[model samples]
Structure formats: C-alpha cells, structure tokens
Target: MTAVMEPGMDAVETDAASSPYQGYVYAYPHKTAYRPLPDRPGLRGLWAGEPQRALSLYIHIPFCEIRCGFCNLFTRIGSPEGLTTAYLDALDRQATAVRAALDGDARFSVAAFGGGTPTYLTAAELTRLFDIAEQRMGADLRAVPLSVEASPDTATADRLAVLAERGTTRLSLGVQSFLDEEARSAVRPQKRAAVEEALGRVRAAGFPVLNIDLIYGIDGQTVASWLRSLDAALAWQPEELYLYPLYVRPLTGLGRRGAEDAGHDPAWDAQRLTLYRAGRDHLLAAGYRQVSMRMFRRTDAPDTGGGDHSCQTDGMVGLGCGARSYTSRLHYSFDYAVDARQVRGIIDDYVATTDFTRAEVGRHLTGDEPRRRHLLQSLLQADGLELAGYRQRFGSTPAEDFPAELAAFAARGWLAEGDADRLALTPEGLAHADAVGPALFSAAVRADMAAYELK
Candidate 1:
C-alpha cells in the first residue's frame, strides 16, 4: 500500500514528513554533550549516600564481527590478537573497584550485557565476562533477570549454551531484515539461512524471552517488502520484537553514502510512517502488544521489564570503556570515540589505567532535569504516565511541571487525559514519538549538545 495521510498526522507528522529524518532521541541530553569531570568523582561517595533503590548493571562488549552501514554505536568492527582478553581483564579490575565502592546492602534486581555485540566473544571469553559481573558486583545471574544483545552472525551454539547455563533471561538478536537485499543495503552482511540457524540456536538454548529486531527504513524498502520481513519474524513467534527506524548518522557507513545520494527526502519519512503503521497494526492483531514505540511483546510473555526495570528507578553500573554509570544527579563514562584509531586508543588507555575507582567524565543534571528525565522516560512508554505517581516522586503533577509542553501535546490531540489521572498518547502521538521525545529536552542541554563535538 502507498503511504498516505492517517489519523494523528497533524502538524508534527507533517513536519516529520517534510524533514529528512526526525532525530532519534534515544536518551535525553545526548552523550555528545557530556563533558569531562576534572575532579573525577569517586564511586564510594556516589554509591554510599545513594537511596536504597534497586540497581541495574550494564556490561558492555565493544567487539563486533562487522560494523553495519547504519550503525553508530561505540564498537569496533573487529578485535585484534589478545584485545578481547585485555578488555576482559580491564573489566575485572573496574568491577572490583566499583563493587568495593558500593554499599554492602545494595540490591541488584537486573543485569544486562550490551555492546557492539556481546556474542562476539568466544564461549570461554563469555564465561569470563560473567565471572567479572558475578564475582565483582555480587550479581548472581541465576537470581535476577539478565539480558544480552547479539547479532545473527556471531550467536554461536557455544556462546548461546554458555548464556543459557548462566541464566540469561533474555537474548535479543538484530535480524534487521529477512531480505538479503535489505540487509545488504544496510551494510550488514548476512545470509537468510544463517539468520534462521542462529534463531533456532537461540530458541533451543531456552532463554525465557527471545527478542528479534527489524529495521524498516533502509535505502531501498517498500510496504510489501517490509511486511515480508515482519511476517518472517512473526513466524518465529519471538517473545519480543523491536522495530527500529533506520537512522543515518555522521561517521556511519550509511551516513557517508547518504551524503552523496539524495540529501533529504520527506517522501522517505512518509514511507517509513506508513510502514510503521502497518507493522504496529499487524503485531497487535497477532496477539502482541506495544510496550513502547519501538518495543512489542507477545501477550503471554512475562513483563519485559519484570524486575528492577519495572520500577524503572534503578541507576545502572556500567563497566568497560563504552559503558556509562549513572546516579541521581549525574551520568558519566569514559570519553566516546567513533573513529577506529581513537576508539582503540581510548580502549588501550582504559586497559592500562590502574585507577578504576572513580568517574572521570560526565555531566550533572540540574534544575528540573531529573524530573524531566522521569517524565520523559515514563511518557514514552505505552502505559503512559500517572499524575499521582509523578507527584509522589517529584511532588508535582505532570501538567504543572511541564505546563506548556503538555498543553501543546493535549491541544494537538496527541495526548489524552486517561483514567485515574494518567496521561497517554493517542494513536497519532505514539507515531510522532521521535519528534515528541526531543521536544521535551531543556534549552541548556540542547545548547550543550549542539556545542560539543560528537567523537
């Protein structure tokens, strides 16, 4: 079907349709804007005075077999000899220091391994990765929900088995497209049969939840083709499906090509919108429900954010150079790098450093940024935000805290005054999530992000 006007395609959708691609506001106050901390705050103080909130741990694996054309995450295409081992060793040291800094009564309810591709490691390396997390952080993989990100090419049987035995609750695979051409256009080299094999392996491994990821807006994609890929994934009956809109960013393979090709096309935006609606409607009909704009899950699947994630209140403990640790007022990580040489240099520096007890680079949230963060995270969910809950946490209603912004959303008919004092997205509002999320960022943060150079 051709892309066309639909309900909720108001001025915002019109705006999206006119622009090249609405920026993906994954995390508010983009990491690009983060500056270095000269004092390099120590972890003991950050973790000691912290409230008794359940904590989530994130372990980053910065190695991948191939860098996709549309990818811009902090990871390298390949690992050199002994690089993985060195990286793991550094992780062990960081975790030990970080754990020592934490209060003894700290509780961990969930853990995740994310990166270029956690599955890129050998089975033995994978086991060691867990060792650092479990031994250093005292996070028992068997007790809490554990999630790991992987790619189809590297999800070997050995790695899958190790993950299963170690009690990984969720295994997410990036099967961007079933069509070989689409996959090629995205600069991800993989065969249909290989992806099928990987899926079968992951399922046989018996992780409670299996999430398959698909991308909708590649260089060459259409309504029928998008459905073909979606239908293929649904046939697998994955517990979760993440529909990602292809984003071309600077320093990415696709970004360079996109620069040379058609610079900006609103028509592409409309096509993506049409495809998104088709996919969302199809998933709902197939007994899957939306958790967020990008996330859908089978009705029978346990809550995606079942543990500490459900509270959505936990701060994350990040290990590895690409990881970011968070606190109530701050978020910090090692400097970020997209260039291969610089990334290697940063990784080498991290591995060589003896001091792993403190954070060296970060940004502090001020004014109502914390409140804004809570609202942004909550409002983006399909469940919406509760006014009483907001008041209880921040002592202010969403309407009062975000008076002008909420009013605009309500006036546009994108937001609804739901039952029990909840504010939710109308069908159209959810469609424009990419735009809405960025609109909520504070002026100062935006300015900081604009000024800072994204490595």
Candidate 2:
C-alpha cells in the first residue's frame, strides 16, 4: 500500500487512509462481517416488526458450468450426477417452509434468480424452479419483474424459451469482454462467436430489459480496447449495461499469481480510472443515462418491471443455501466459501440436511448501522440522497448525524449540495467512491469482518 502525506495527519494515519482497492462495498456491512448464529433465528422473529410489508425474493442457483479467474462470488463449479435434482428438492422444501413463515399477509412484489449462473440448470429444471415460486409461494412469476442471470455458454435456446414462457422481464448476461485476447487475459475463456450467439438468443427470448455486463482493466486492456467493448455493447442496443472494473481478491485464481502482483498497482489504478471515464463518456454520448457508478440504462428503455421496492430498506427472502435473506434487523445466509473444495464441502452439508428453515449464520445490525446504511446507499447513487426524505424517516438530516464525513467529502470537492434538499457526488467523487465507502465503515464492523474465517 502506498502512503499519502496528508496535511495535518501523521504518516501512519495517512497510510491507512490511502490504501487503494480496500474492498468493494456492494451491500452494507459486508457479508464477511456475519458470524454463525448458534441459536438460528426463526423467520418469524427475523421479520417480525419489520415495517415494510412487501418483500423481494432472491433465489440463488449456485451451479456454474465454468468458474472465472477473478470471480469471488458464492458459487461452485458443475454439480455431480443427481446433485441438481437433490438440490431442487431441498430448495422446494426450504421455499415451502419460508412461505409458511411469511404468513398470508406478507406479499412478494419483486423476484430474481441470481447466481454463478441461473441458466446452468436445464430447461426442465428451470421449469421446476419457477414452479416453486409460482405454485408453492403464490408469488406469480408472471406478475413480478423477474430477473435471471445467465452466461453465454449456458443460456441455451430451450432454457431461454422456458424463461420467456415464465414471465422473465430482464435477462442479464455476463459478457465480460468482446475481445478474445482480453477474455483469455482474464482467464474467462470465451470466444466472440459464442458471446454473439448468446446475445442473439437473449434478445430473441423477448425479455423487456436486457442487461449486458462488461469488465475493464484486464491485463493488457487499453483505452481503445475499452471503447471497442462499449461500441460492441451499444450494437446490441441493450436496455441496460453495467461496466465493472476488474478486482483481484483473495482465493481467486488470479489472486494466487504472485505476491508482488497481488494488489492494485498505482499504474493499473491510473489506467482503470482513465478507461472508466472513456467508457462513461461514450455511454453518455450514446444516449444512456448513468444509474449508479457502474450501471447505465437506455434513456427510453421500458421501466415496467420490478415495482418501486428499494433494496436498501426492503425485506428480502433468500431460498437457496448461498442466498442471503435480509430483514430490518439482520442479514443471514448459509456459511460462505470461496475455495472449490471448501465450497463443495459446504454444499454437501447443505444437501444432507433436513431442516430447510431459519438463519444459520448472520450479523445483527445496531440502531446506528441502519442510518449509516441509508446514507451509503443513497449517497452512492447519481441522483443523490434526498435530505427531506431522510429527515422524515430518521428525524435528522444526514449532514447533522454525519457532519465530519459529509464535511470531509465537501472539503475534498467530492460532494455538492443540489436542489436544496438533495446531496450528490460530483463525477470525481464517484470515481473515489471505493475510498470513501471504506472510510465510512464502522471500526467494529470492519474488525469483525476482517476477523471472520473463510471456509
């Protein structure tokens, strides 16, 4: 880590402040912060008194045909014979138990299937998965904005047909790159022909929204090459596009390359920032509006799916072992694992188990933590946080509760007050979100997350 000599700060303090690529803060209080709950909390207690009545359902399919080099998600490679069938059976049992826990009053307005790759299941298996949501839970997949993640290799025509038949509004395909060399550089091992074929099939599937995910900053990737990817994605006229910067994390294939090359280099950081600007500007010119730092949606794309449920505060029910269920009080899931062997062991444990209800491992949030989460989630968006709405919910403004944090950002030219009741980040500030996010992490949460052991 490089040290920055900040004015009025000692070397040690500055060094801690300047560490690059600390960690990606997608969800508040990172999953690594959770610990095993010896007395697993039943769903009733977890959801009891949660103000929000409507819920979003997240179903995880942890099987993937291929594992990428930089992937650190909770998933494993292809399952052995009969494992898929058994997994489905267990998933149904869990779903049934969870549905009963929710009671008749609780409603599901949004549903999604995400994973190593949701399309990893066969067309018939996909049918069974939908049946659990529709028949068992009464959350009509046809009525909600259902999204499913897939990869080019696994999104077969038959599978796409099944998804189309079952009311899938959005189909997200992880087309990391258009260049064959870059794919090889990232150890993703995909060809241009295959990606194009997958794109064609997804479009033919007739989902209301098509999201294409592309990655930049791979080894040997250049500004010109990044624009080529942008241009290629634009050719698809996708409803949404997400550009992700490459991150190498522990236990990943690329993480084991060498000690010297382990973390983000100063040179690589500069390159990624430049390429991010290029991609952002290109998308803007192509009539796509930035949603968050990474997400961009077509200006005229249909927003007919996924009702106005905000993931920041809404309750979510997660069915699969890898899936995480979130309540106002806690976020819980099965034990997380990254290593292939460790993940396999955990999967084995999950399959052999008969109990399909309650939270096994999770972290309970303190009162202040929820307020901080509200700030982090709202502040990171392009639209910024609404000061009035925040004050109405929490009885205090963000500026009042987190004065030092907001002042520090403002002093650094990263923050801007807009339209009287809103606060937003300048483009430069959004570029530094990774740095700012970690700074906002409570010391206690960070310590717990750091101390947790990975299986």
Candidate 3:
C-alpha cells in the first residue's frame, strides 16, 4: 500500500493502522475536503446538463434542544427568540431559488429532514416546512418516502401527529441508551421514563417504519449493559436499528473534556468491537438482517419502497445552512463548523444572504474520484459491489484499478472468499468498517481534509 502512495495517502494509512476507528465515512470526500469555489458556478449551469428526475431532496434543521457530549454535527444548541422563524424564512427563499434553478423538470423520488433535530420545531413550524417543500420546491411529500429524525423531548404528540399526517414513512428516534446512568455518561441527559414515553408516542403516530438509534462503548459501559440496551430497544420491535460507536471528536463535549484520543486507546477499541459483535449476533438471532455496519432491519418489517434514488449516482438538492447538495460533478454546501459560536455565525450568514443561486464552497469530483466513491459506498454495504456494474460504468474492474489496496485487504483476511461476481467484506472486515472506509480515501481528499482547520 505504501508503494502505491499518491503523495498524501501515507498519512491516512498510518492513522488507520493506529486505530480501527478513524472516522465514519457516511459520505465520501467529507465536508472538510470542500473549499471555497473561486468560480462560484451558477446553480442553473450546474444542473443544465444533469439529470433532474429521481433526485433526493434534503432539508436540514440546525437547531437542537441540547448538544450531546459525543456530538460534533453542524448545529446550534437552541433557537433564539426569532431564530426559528428567521431560519424558516431563509429556507423558503433558498427553496424557491433552487426550484427555479432546476428549470421545471425536477422531481424528488425520496426526501429526508435531518439535523440537529427536525422535530425541534413546533407543530405549526413543521407544517410550514412541509408547505415550503411542496409549494415552493414542488416536492410532493405524500408521493414519496420521507424520513425524519427526532429526539425524545421533541417527539411530542402534536409533532408526531403532524409527521404522520404529512406522510412521514419513517421516524428515527435517537435513544442512545436505555439506562439513565449510561445516558448521562454519554452526555445525552435523558431519563428512561421520557424515552419510553417518546417511543410510545412514535408508535401511536402510526408511521410505517420506526428506527431506533443506540450507542455502544460509552464510558463504564459493560457487555452486559450493552446487551440490556439492545434488548430494551428490541422491545419496541422497530423496523430498523442503527448501532453507532461512540466517537469523541475535536470540538465535541467529550473532546473539550480532553477525551479526544479515546478512539486510539487499544482497550477502548477492543471494548467497542466486543460490544458491536454482541449486538450484531443478538439482532441476527432475533430475526433481523444486517444492512450495513451500522444499520439493521427486522426481517418481517414492511418495505417503505423508496429504493428508486441511489445515493451513489443520483443528484441531491439540499436546503439549509447545514445541508449539502450533490451533483455528479460536485458536492457543495455552506461553510461548516463544530464550535457553537462558529456554527451560529454561519447560520446568521445563511439567513442574511439573498442570492442562493451559486455554489459557495464545494469539491469537484475529478479523475477516478467517481469510481472510488462508487466502490467505497457500495462495497461497504452488506450486499457489496457487483463486478459487472463496475465494468459497465467505468470500463475497468475494481481489481484492475485498485490492485494494491485489494491485495492488502485480502492478505489481512478482510475480503470475503469465493465471491467472483461481487466484491464483499468478510465478517471481521465488516467489524473494522471504520478502518476500511478511511483506507480507501483518495489522496487529494485526504490532503484537503488534513489541511482543513476545525474551527
């Protein structure tokens, strides 16, 4: 792997070798890799020759009731006196501009409202949000699958009602732990009683799919306690479950408390891996199927039927201060930050701006980036990447383009055996997903990410 280095690849490989938990590669070429686009290309020009149908629509709400210790997402702690209203007004304006830029041929196959917490808004505000998506952006929420994220406190009856009425196919609740002590240890500060009440409300709301998120490897968290949390969530019989490892990154509450190097601790890594395997086997025995390293679904759960839009190849229209829009050639978003003050500053600028028609900060996908992204995202899934599809799209096989990396994985016993038509990972390989994801980073992206200063 070192011999095939392209200037900046060594740093990432070294980091991955130090710890199996580097970072979560939810999206390739992370926001840290994005820089100011000097050309500031017009959105119309960006979309003129691109396909518009079957696009994914994303609306980001950057306000959360409270900031958890392990959280480093782009969001503010709370909305000031008029901040929520002002933010919604800005969202409406941005939606109008984006809709016009699409030139009337845009159609959304799926939509999601993520954040901080989209349910942080009042019921009336949520209604206005749906109206903006439908009336201004021309996205018919009822015609597509919509997913929304919520915290326990914000999953009120009124809010849940509005979500159910407006066609929310999936409601994901972030219940990091079932034990009160564990929740406090994770800096989530939620009571078990409140979480139960929230889950009951979500079930009463009658959404087709309910997803519960849990966390493993918290301080003082033992294997027995981890199983308790998993069993607690299983009582809900949720359609989906996302088990996330606790990552204490820079600027987060845990990091500020001097726990930034927690992931590098060998003991901590072993604890997380042990807990992850326990949770995985527990779910599999309970009749659930693994979708990815973090996601699992009940075998009998109803299919929400929004598989038309593929994140690997389709375009995405994102609206908000923290949202990101993806085109085949570029991925763009507003300036990103994790510090509370810097995040607030960016939100203020987003609200004050009138011209939302040009790209401000972005990264262009050039050379073999598209291929790397396709392989990275697909191979991470439980089904893995199909060999024929790779050949059809790029006119080259993964083994041919990434001989050294593939050989390294095989030597490490990460590659699954006897799967000639698909490139998949072994069970142990899936356990080290965080490491595998970072190891595949392009040199240019790694360099840019290394250079980015975390405000």
Q: Every model's Cα RMSD, please?
A: 4.7, 4.9, 4.3
Model 1 lowest lDDT segment of ten: 1-10
For candidate 2, give the lDDT. Answer: 0.79
lDDT of 2 by residue, 1-455 (tens): 00000011011112223543445566777767778998998887777777445688888888888778777777788989999898889888888888877767777889989877889999999999999988777787888889889999988899999999999999988988899999999888899999999899988888999998898889999999989988988999999998887777667667657522534477777887798889999999999998777889999999866675787778888888788888888889888887788888887887777876678988888867888888888888888888887888789988888888788888888887556879888887777666666667777777776676655
- Residue pairs in steric clash, candidate 1? none
Separate clash counts for every candidate: 0, 0, 0
Ranking by lDDT: 3, 2, 1
Stretches of candidate 2 exceeding 4 Å from the true structure:
1-20, 259-262
TM-score of each: 0.93, 0.94, 0.96
The stretch of ten residues in a row with the least summed lDDT in candidate 3 is 1-10
lDDT of 1: 0.79
For each candidate, the alpha-carbon lDDT, in order, equals 0.79, 0.79, 0.87
Please write out the lDDT profile of model 1 over residues 1-455, one tens digit for every residue: 00000011111222322353455655555666578998888888877777544888889888788878777777787887999999998999898999898888777778989888899999999999988888888987788889899888788899999999998999999889999999898888888999999999998898899999898887789888999999999988999999987766666677677542232566677788888999999999999989887889999987545575533356878899988877887888998876667777888898897889888888898898888788888787888887787888888887788898887777777786647688888777788777777677777776676676645
Candidate 3 structure lDDT: 0.87
lDDT of 3 by residue, 1-455 (tens): 00000111113544445677777777877888889999999999999878888899999998889888888888898888999999999999999999989958789999999988899999999999999999999998988999999999999999999999999999999998999999899888889999999999999999999999999999999999999999999999999999888887888788899997776799999999999999999999999999988899999999889758988888999999988899999999999998899999999999998999999999999998998899898988888999998899899999998887788788888889897899998888888888888888888988888888878
- Candidate 1 error regions (>4 Å): 1-21, 260-264, 303-305, 309-312
> Judged by TM-score, which candidate is best?
3
